[model samples]
Target: MRLFLLAAIAVLSTLRVAMADSAIGFKQTELPADAGGHALTISLWYPAAPLGKTETVGENAAFYGLEVQPDAPFLTGSRPLVLMSHGFGGSWRNLNWIAGALVRQGFVVAAPDHKGESFTEADATEIVPLWERPRDISRTLTALLDHDDLAGGIDRGRIAVIGHSLGGWTAMELAGARYSADLALKDCNRAKLPPQCKAPRLLGKVGIVGDGKADPRLAMDWRDARIRAVVALDLGPAAGFLPETLQQVEVPVLVLAAGVETPEIAAIKADSDYIARHLPGATTVYREIPDASHFSFMQICKPNGEKIVEELSPGEGFVCRDGGGRDRAALHAQISEAILDFLKVDMR
Candidate 1:
């Protein structure tokens, strides 16, 4: 028993040392309504100076968190900025893992818990107004540029955007892809209620689901020229964008499709495949991660994570699950490497 205790203590001591050595700094703040027409809750991660307390970011009952220094001073000198948006019913925490990885690569990352559509505030009426999501990213960029401490450190010309699932749709829009609500509904009508059409009856909720009279705002161009490149992961609602608009996107784009298929996940052919086909060949690149599922891009789950999610919301534990008995950490590493490589080449 004494030997076992000593071994446990040694293991914990090593973990503490590793956590203390993390180079990532994390900070969470609320930007006022004046900045985005509604209050925005955001998390920022960046390279840190060698000081401050190490704490886990995004820890919860179901998902594991990454260690980071809270409110640590950022490493000086300009660094590129990468803005992230989470999938439907997700918060900034959903992509916190990648944010930490990007920080280690000398990039500043910011993710906003989008108003109305975020995990805490999801509502059919609110989410139907999808244009608000891209606006949220723009407002976040504005806030960062106006921030006294962050402004000087952000390399404006090197800005890029990365997003997963619904957030992927948002990233494409900001990169100059114009949405076509009619096309979205047409695609939905053909498919057997693809994942995006399931919850909240996003299409039917607006009373335009069957009639095809989509909200005009859904067709608006939400492009933000500051985003020099875009990386979209397993994007849903991909059929909604006009092909011409996609071809017009001058910036480089990397579209990654998850390999595994599931009822709850978006279809590769209708979404990711469609984007790859329509996007300008010269500026767009597509890759599929064979071992990944739609949920694989999310944070790693705890050992009992699936059970915990099932208890909270029956049949919804897939968020805590992955495909083919694959390792989440390894998948994360693969994803981060792909993104870093893409950014390194394209952001130049």
Candidate 2:
């Protein structure tokens, strides 16, 4: 335990925020779900007074970054809006690094904690319907656009979204990729699907269940037209997408995948590779992090993560640890730069 503590401290020291020279605004606000089921909390990072102070996000079990004035007024100019979505079982805090980076780059970032799959909320009904993920984003967009304080500063015509793993799939759907049960079964199977894929499980709650093949309800349109482009990071559930609908996508897309062969990458490799080729979008780039893991795309673990892990469950800290001896902080820097570069050209 002595050695472990020392090692954990060293790892934490390496991620010392590198001391940002500029400040980006950050705030968390709850928005009522349009469905009126579960309320949604959105973590927003945008341009603000560049105070050099630092603050922890959430409980700091996951990450810590630049501090933002609480509910700071929007920066004086119009900026593209970038909606953020975390992976299943993750909170907006998962993408703090990316959100902070984008907000500094003059783009507004809002990440909604999908109630059922997020850190604080878990429910079979809210999480089971795959379509609900994109719908969450769509509803949030509407609310953001209508909010008196936010509407004027947003570039309604220039909207982009970034999401990791399950959120990556959500980004695709929001970017106009529809779901087709038949097309999905070709390369996806029940055994490989996540628990959220269990439609019967959700159907049973609503007193609706069909014969064994698949819940026909899975074949519905969840795409949101407001998303002009997307950056999908290590997406999962290859079978949930319909190629016919994916072919219909015409926006810019950047698909980043983890190169390592862990279960995380295994879960999304098919879908990532397929979208790289299938997103008929005029501009598309698929880049694999040579030695990175899927979770490496997320913020590095908090320095005290070891203690936090002891308090949480086993798989809780699994994504926090990356293989290949990669520096998680350094990786976040690179990924942030890569994404900003992509958005620079695509979003413009």
Candidate 3:
């Protein structure tokens, strides 16, 4: 219901000092789904008993220079569960910094590698089923709360989901959004369409829109009752949802968008605005990060990341680089604090 200005300035001022004494240890584990889900390699950060070992945690192999204490014993205390969803073509390590900070603040954080969207997939089908992203979160939550090795000391009632980009769309869907085919067609038809939007339009031109409920998953209900709150970071294309559909979303939501304008980002910014105004029961706080781009929400690049990106794609810019003299670490710390604050109020 309000815009928070100079938000990062305030959050970072206090967070810097508080984090000096917070828990910075974590336990990394992998879990396989029983059926109908992707295999997950997740990271768990918690207040811990010193294990005397440190492991580098960043974009694995590519940018693993941020050293962290791994496999440390869990902190003894009641802690809420926070499930993190990465953006398309991203890895769980993209949000490792945020997860580490959340654990330091008395919350157990878990970031899962979503099917199709993760970096390991080798084919197109591995990444195109965007409809299943929310289900992937739901399945992972189930694994955390009910599966033996994975389920322990989790405060089920105080659960929350944090997602970025495509994962943001996933979080909204799980927060009780129902898709409308009609609105989807209309949004895709908007001026200055992005690459993803253009695909559906091309398909429609060939009369491939198909029959009503043709793709049952298009309008499927994927909301998980246990998700008490959601935090969407620079949410991706959301034309599939209308304000009326989002009215069904009753949980608290905090939607954040980057302050850059491009053909690709313009649509996403609009989606964030609509979601902020429409999600019914949420005491929504719509904020924009000054001087940030879409990739700003992901991991802070390592010292050699620019060279690495260039080597991978010649003549292309480092996709993860932030513009306008912004420090990725500072920006991340600010957002992480905001998330903790919002969840503390609503999850209580």
For each candidate, what is the lDDT? 0.78, 0.69, 0.68
TM-scores for candidates 1 onward, in order:
0.87, 0.81, 0.83
Candidate with best TM-score: 1
Candidate 3 wrongly placed segments (more than 4 Å): 1-23, 59-66, 123-125, 147-151, 187-196, 201-214, 262-266, 314-316
Model 2 spans with C-alpha error above 4 angstroms:
1-22, 35-37, 50-54, 59-62, 122-128, 186-217, 303-307
Residues 1-348, model 2: lDDT tens digits: 122111344543432332233357677778864554557777777776555555656546446655565565555656678898888777787787787777666677888888766656646235545666777788788888888474237777778889898899889888778765545444235466653345445434322333334455555666777777789998876565677777778777889987775753454666788788787645787898877788898777777774576577665556666766668888787788778767656422
Candidate 1 vs candidate 2: which has greater TM-score? 1
Best by lDDT: 1
Taking the candidates one at a time, how many backbone clashes does each contain?
0, 0, 1
Pairs that clash in candidate 3: 116-126
Rank candidates by TM-score, best first: 1, 3, 2
**Over all chains combined, what TM-score does candidate 2 have?**
0.81
lDDT (10s digit) by residue, model 3, range 1-348: 221211345554454455455445665667766576557667666666555677776644345434567665555544578888888777777777777777666667777777555546664235545556777677777777774345247767778899998789889888888766656665445587644456654333322263322255657788889888889998865766768868767778888887775543456677787687787744667788876778777777777776876787564345556756667877877788778777766521
Error of 1 at 44 (Å): 0.5
Model 2 whole-model lDDT (C-alpha atoms): 0.69
lDDT of 1 by residue, 264-302 (tens): 665753599989898888777799888789999999999
